[model samples]
Target: MENPAEVLRRVFGHEGFRGLQAGIVAHVMEGGSGLVLMPTGGGKSLCYQVPALCLPGLAVVVSPLIALMEDQVAALRQQGVAAAALHSDLDEEERFEIRRAMARGELRILYVSPERLVMDGTLDNLARREVSLFAIDEAHCVSQWGHHFRPEYRGLTVLAERFPLVPRLALTATADERTVDDIRRQLVLADAPVFRGGFDRPNIFITAEPRETERAQLRAFIKRASDGRGAGIIYCGSRRKTEDTAAWLKQDGHDAMAFHAGMEASAKREAHHRFARGDAVIMCATIAFGMGIDRPDVRWVAHTDLPKSPESWYQEIGRAGRDGLPAQALLLYGPGDIALGRHRIQESPASDEQKRIERGRLEAIVSIAESATCRRRALLRCFGEDLEEDCGACDACATPPKMWNGTVAAQKMLSAVLRTGQRFGLGHIIDVLRGRMTDKIAQHGHDQLPTFGVGKDLPDHTWRGVARQLVSRGALDVAVENHGELLPTDQARPILKGETQLMLRADTVSKASTPRESSAPERGEDPVFDALRQWRRDEARNQGVPAYVIFQDKTLAEIAYRKPRSLDGLAGVPGVGTSKLDKYGDAVLEVLLEAGA
Candidate 1:
């Protein structure tokens, strides 16, 4: 068998594996089954991608997302690799051609969504192929206990039962100890070696403010961050948010796109294509947008709302700096963001068990928000891993925000709820505090309540903060279908009856920092470099791994500018090593010197 380094360089155009990847490639190549819990941008895809190429048959990837398959396939084909996908998107003719190719061993890796795999027909068709490896992406979805659980992923174990001779690798960016155990049980990976990569990305810097900066703060953050060094992603929580943010960003003269599942399939595909080509510098999307996106040189990943789990947070942030170059992660949390999350959970149609699990997930997210300790420490601990390095980049590291004991404000907000019969959302409650007797106020007859205008002593913004803080602390619950109809949690009973006291937070607005451009070397907006990176990413995709594992953006820029002429010359570059010279050495060098890399 070829050495791991040789295989990596030849297949992925890289000199060697980063972190646990070399070991992982070795294990998988030796016919070992394993579970890989690598953070996003940690080179998780390469563990199976390179080895699968060296092996003789198809490395069937049981993916939980179809968009992921499309993205990977498009990337792979761009790099001149023989790869295809068998998902619902393909027509019968397309599926038949792909199936024929798989049987003939023309395709190295074929991706299929787990929901499609669960069907007898789809599994039966793929079973006829000479399968060598079975790689499961988003393995956490196999467990119902995971933050984003998918019921269909449970059928993946059927592949193991059916293909006893093929080696397997289950991979995920998110999973705690319990979720990990659940994944093992569901996917039946008892014998797989476990490779857990550390969860810290040193390049990312985390900072948060109260929810008060919804539009204004977001606009300010975007303007300051887009110094035009490289592309970044701004993750919003909903479809509407994505559109609104994307629109606002466009007005600021930035090339941005809004991507969500709510968009038409054609529109989504176009958006993906644009983002992949680096034609757009920023994407304001829901979580769905990042899964299929394996782009390197994504300078940053920011969140406008709180993510549901540390696993999810790490995965989202992991999308940046895949090339191991410096990048940034900006996590913005508002008190209302927490409340909205809780209210939705409390209103879900889940069973008792599901509700309990959901609550646990919510609490875990809160722990990250409330953590005055190292953010990385809290995040890694939640995943059942340890962080030896203190993250000097997050808010906790730079300057921790002082905690607000909103006990009095909580009591006042709770009192308003009790007096108003607990039927209002934050806006109405705020109005009652500011004593604004508007038409809606009169329509609801809330103006007559003794507490209607009692909150007049506090500003509208301060009142809003108090109510949101109360909800985040669990003294109140917002009804789901009714949309933010406030109700008292059992904890509020003591405060209501005077058995316990409450405090209100006086929300403070921080002074805005002057906007500054990024300090990175200015890479000009040359279409040739953009084209070369897209070409390189395409090659990486067909091989079925992340593009960063193939070549970094800096290296891509070097190739685009200098156009290295020989293998020896290629090996002289910063990221290039001996292994890469042998495998992708000639091909990439050709593109660099002449056309595309």
Candidate 2:
């Protein structure tokens, strides 16, 4: 049997394992079942992929989406591995070819969707083969309480019941304590040791902005992120918003595309193909777009509306910086998002217990958004993991948001909510605070109230920001039963009575990075870097792969900086694996020599 380390170095192109990866790989190779919780790009696939290669038989990988399965299979095949995906998308001939390869014992890894795996006769056929192991990707989907729960994932438990002798490995990038427990119970991996790689993506600089002029904010962030350079994904809350955003970006002269579940199947595939193969394309999409995407040079990820939970937010942002380059995660959410999120929880058909748990999770997300300290620290702490100190990468750590004593603002919001009977929502209370003498106010006799117009000095968005912080801090609560009305909590008494001090962020987005630290190139570009990127783009196009799949931005940067003169010199760059070096060595050297001339 080939050693796992040899497989990693030769096939995957990495020198060695990172953190808990080696332990997990060895455990799986020793025929032990387990659960893996590693952040994206933390090499979760290697835990199972390496063991599958070292073992004797075919390893069945149960993935969530067909696109993801196909991407993994292609990337693996590029490394001289015999891997194939058996999803519904395959034609009869393709399916027959895969079956023939399997029957001939010519395949090492196979990817299948959970829906197809549980179908009748699928396992029976697999039982006839010498199955090595089972890998469940996106295992968190099995948790009914998770944000991205899939009903089909629950049926995966049969893998254990039917193939008890085969080691089963489940992997996910985002799962809170509850989600992890749920995954374990659902997957029936009772005795399997859980290997947690920690919930930290230091490569991604996280920031959140209040949703005032969200369109303009998103545009500015995307402009700074791509800067006519790398690719990115702009996540919207709705399909219409994605379409409109994509169109607007195209009008603004960006090479942008729109992707959503509402699009035609062929359109979706085309969009995916364009993004996977094209350069510097800004994909305006809903959350449904990125799950299975393997594009590695994504410079940033922006959310025009807030994500439902920290787990969802983490997973979305993790998509960026997969190549370990500096990437940005900019989230823009407004006061409306809070009410909408609570309303969603209320409207859900979940049991009261589930609703209460979801309500807590939503509040935690709000806390992270409104956090005044280091954003990365707050995010890690959300998953019950703590950072020893503040990380300097996040927007807050680099350039902290200016904060002001918001006690008076908090008091005013609480007073307005109370004086208005606490039955009205944020919009109504804001109207009352700003002295809007609309018919509703006059009809309710609220125009005559003393709190009316008392907060007129503050802008509506500013007051909304204040109210959002208060709610996040527990001074105010959304009354879901009464159509998202604002109500005072016990914590409100301290602020209302001037016993507790409050501070609110004055601005939404943090200061932009300096030219040296930004993902965008400075005005004066490095000729070698540009030349190498051009070469990589051309090579990727010829090979029908994403540019990052051929050579990540980080690798190109290293090659340019070193200006390697020989194939041996080029081989020393971190991302230049044996397969890539053997194929692109001469081309990279030529680009370097020409640029130096």
Candidate 3:
């Protein structure tokens, strides 16, 4: 068997192993079973991929995505490793050819979806041979309690029972404690030695903005994130958002394409190819678009709307900086997104118990948005990881905002909503707060209410603050279809009656990173700062890699703050791998010394 370091170089053009990768590979090579919880780009695939090559017989791998299977197979084949996939998308001839190759002992790695794995003869065929290993990729989807539940994935354990000789390895990029346990139980890997890699990626700077005009905001986000350079992903929550944003970006003269389940397969494949070949700058897409893309130069991943949960957020942002370059994770949460997310679960065909769990997950997402504490800490906590302080890479860490007591303000808002029968939305409620006397008020005959105009002292923007903070804090929920229809939640009951207090963080504005009038102390870790940019030419270029893969502004800021001078020192600088250091270290050092770092 090739040494793990040699395995990396031979297969993927890397010359070394990251912290836990070698350990994981060794465990698998020794025929031990385990679960792996690693962040994206942590070499999770290599953990099993290397062992498969060293093992005696065909390694049967289960993946949730056909695109992922095909991409992996192509990459493997590119390196002269024999791999093939069996999926529904393959034609009869393609399927038969794959079967023939496996039967002839010509295929080394066989990839199949969980659905195909559960098919009658698929396991029997694998069981007939040595079947060295079974790898479950994106294993988090197997649990019914999981957000991305796939019923077919539950049948994955059938192979484990039939082919007990094969070592099983379950891997996922974003799974919390509950999700990890769910994967273990569903896949029947009871005593697997779980290998957990660090969730902290200091190179990736995270920020969030409340989405106002979602379309307009997303448009502006896409433009600014490009920083006049390499490709990025703008993930929309729905197909309409994807098509509309992709079209608008094209009209705005950006080289963009749309990818979604709603599009034709050929179009989807074309878009994926265009993105991989660096022909597209931004691919406007729904959740369906990002599953298996292997491109590593993506500089940014922006969520135009809030995702269903932190796991979803982690997975989406994971796509960026795969080549170990610094990336930006810019998330936009429209106030309306919470209701939509919850209503999605509420409307799902599930048992009441499942609905309750789903609702809790949605509520947890909203807390992530509103929390003034460290955003990364809160997120890591959700996934059973604990970080003591703010992660300087996130918004809360970069710009510390102030908190104001909004307990009185929340009481007043809830009183008004309930006093008025809870039928009207924010617009009407705002009107009553400002003492605006209009025909609509008289038509509804709400003017005579005791709470009418009682909130005249609060400004319109202040009222906006009260509303935004309340929703963030879970005192209220907007109607899913009618986001305008704000309703008090059970949480609001005690607060409205003056039983509880609300202290909301005063919103802070983060300025763009440019030469400020006076230098402010820097916060993030970017080895190259002080020097201004070279040109606004095409991004994702330099040293045979994409531009976004270089150094993001936030990372640059961090580097400017903590000037590291050695390889080990620079290694702590987010995204500065041995490969990156070998390629760009001198240039970065020149910038640092020139800037007096």
Candidate 3: stretches off by over 4 Å: 227-229, 343-349, 437-439, 445-459, 481-483, 489-493, 508-597
Scored against the true structure, residue 20 in model 1 reaches a CA lDDT of 92
Taken over the whole model, the C-alpha lDDT of each candidate is: 0.73, 0.83, 0.73
Model 1 residue 435 lDDT?
84
Q: Which candidate's TM-score is highest? A: 2
- Which segments of model 1 are wrong by more than 4 Å? 74-81, 91-97, 115-129, 330-340, 370-373, 388-390, 404-461, 479-490, 493-507, 511-551, 557-567, 574-597
**True-vs-predicted CA distance for residue 336, candidate 1, Å:** 4.9
lDDT tens digits, residue span 1-597, model 3: 567666566445455778888888888888888899898877788888888888778988898777678767765664557899999889999989998898888888999988888888877777677788999988888876565778889888786688776789999888877788889987788888889998876656777766655567566556555554347998988889888888888898888777888888878777776676563378889988766777665778889888887788888888977656567777777556876777788789989987887777777777877767677787787777888766677767666666888887788788888877788788898887677888878887778877788788877656766787777766777886764678999999888778887777765333232111212233333324435123101323333322333544444555566777765666566535445556556766666777677
Count of clashes, each model: 18, 0, 13
Task: Write down the TM-score for model 2.
Answer: 0.90
Query: Each model's TM-score, in the order given?
Result: 0.81, 0.90, 0.81
Query: What's the C-alpha lDDT at position 275 in model 2?
Result: 82
Q: Clashes in candidate 3: how many? A: 13
In model 3, how large is the Cα lDDT of residue 161? Answer: 84
